[model samples]
Target: MPSPFILSGCSGGGKSSVLDELKDRGFTVVPEAGRRVVADALQTNSNALPWIDPLAFCRACCDLHMQDLAKLPNQERRVFLDRSLIDLFAYLEMKRISVPADLGAALRAVSYAKTVFLTPPWQQIFVNDQERKASFKEAALEYEHLLSSYRSLGYQVTLLPKTSVADRTDMLLNELDQMDA
Candidate 1:
């Protein structure tokens, strides 16, 4: 399968908002795995939550992300992934946890566009939701980790300008159009 374009950054930095806008415009987008794992855990009253069992939570995200990728059409579909398996790997590294063997193999099995659109941390737009409980400070730290990790993995980081969602969406589309050319 062809690689996807990923939107990733700090947890609450509006990656989802941009993806929402793209979806509104009828573009194909993959949901973030972390949020889905958290929501599922909460619904099932499972202890695989980040606060309770972080390693398990990370593994769950990896599994879900892989599943999400599996559902993609095996072609250059121009799919935009909201975060990715690498983001789960970044989270593991940030927490100083060792990556499981299956996780490494899974990472090797897939690829994404070399350029990743990263939303910078903006305290003004950050909010504390039930799924995302990280404080702004913590989220900023996570952003640093994601930036470092993506660079280490040879992905070019494109920081999304801090602006209204509409502007961000337009900028992203322009980039995608260039990539298409």
Candidate 2:
């Protein structure tokens, strides 16, 4: 079976960039579904979801992740996940949004990569692009929340080095290579 590798962290943590690099190296990369969904909703209708409800948005996000997980091909050597379902909890906690009982339980069952790669907050490389909706400080809190959630679930999380994007990509690839050896 092909092991899925999840790249998760705060906004502007270079998760997407690293995923692109891995994709270029012949790895199957699943882009962040939340971003894609939001962009599409915005483009399709000006006020498609103007009044954002955290619970509603999170439900959609979870569904998107489940879809991605189901579509994975076992023959692929590696699958790179841009974000995992656990992200929804981070968003909920950050926004102080109440998590419904169903959503909370469902999220716990959503399995991500065994070795989740986390990118620490790197201010030098963190730029607020159009797609990046969270500020540096907000992202910091969200990152912490994410770490806590994963730890609480007993998932072993690995922190990616705070270095050049290329170097980080190489480091993860090397780690995966060792695992495959």
Candidate 3:
């Protein structure tokens, strides 16, 4: 399986936009699991929400992420993932929820690209939606947690510039090109 290149950071930090841009540029991409999980819960009126039951919510997100990872085709091309399994741990930390041992083990087992692209808190582009309810302050805190989590896992975290989507995509593609070189 191709090792995924992860774009992870605070919600509303334009990670999704970057993923979209990458997709447009013909790269395989994985959508954020948490957004899909939350949207499904809301649609089904389930209690698996972050604010309602963070553990359950995180578990669902992780399951989705694992499923997505399992479906990735084995190839040489790099797949761009909006987030990875480690994001669950970061979310649990930010929410002050206990991280399950199984979750930790899973995080240790799963692998991605050695370098992760991290989008810092961009207040100008940050906004709340149905799936993203975290305030800018909360988002910033989450960004810090993600930074720590990814670094602790020994992945090199490259901070994406707080710039336009096109500029960010150009920067990311350029970095990937250098990696290929």
Candidate 4:
């Protein structure tokens, strides 16, 4: 089985930066599903839908995740994920959106990453990117939710140590190396 690696954390927790580093290290990486779905929804339905069709958005996001999963090459032994199915649960829980049974089961079937790289919220690095909508507080809540979701699902999550980006890169790689030993 490919080593599924999830980079889970708040929006401003340097998740994207981590993705960049991992990609530089020659690991195949999957982008976040939420931003992509939301962007497409905005372009198509200007009047409404996303605000009203929370379930639909969640479904779309789930489908995107599945697509990402399917796109992974079988020959690859390790792949980095920007987020995971657990985020869908977190998004629904935060938005008070109901999850469908099929979606829930699919999420349950998603084998979580052996090592979940989590970057804690850093207010300094946190900025209002074009895609970012949630406030720091809200992101923090979502971050907590993501952590709980993974733990609840029994994943062996590894919180990225508080260090420079380069250090974090080395730390994560070293941790994985140790795990493989």
TM-score of each: 0.95, 0.87, 0.96, 0.90
The TM-score, computed over Cα atoms with residue i paired to residue i, of candidate 2 is: 0.87
lDDT of 4 by residue, 22-74 (tens): 88878888999877887777778732234557678778878999998988888
Candidate 3 regions off by >4 Å?
Answer: none
> Model 1, 55-151: lDDT tens per residue?
8898898888889888987765577999988887778887888989988998999888898999999988999988998889989988998999899
**Model 2 Cα lDDT, one tens digit per residue, 47-110:** 3231465666677677777788888887658788987877777778777777788777776665
**Tens-digit lDDT track for model 3 on 71-172?**
988887779998988888888887778899988877877889999999999999999999888899999998999999999989999999988899999998
Instruction: List the pairs of residues colliding in candidate 3.
Output: none
lDDT for model 3, please.
0.90
Q: What is the lDDT of residue 116 in candidate 3?
A: 96
**Candidate number with the higher lDDT (3 or 4):** 3
Best by the lDDT measure: 3
What overall lDDT, based on C-alpha atoms, would model 2 receive against the true structure? 0.77
Candidate 1 residue pairs in clash (backbone atoms < 3 Å): none
Give the clash total for candidate 3.
0
Best by TM-score: 3
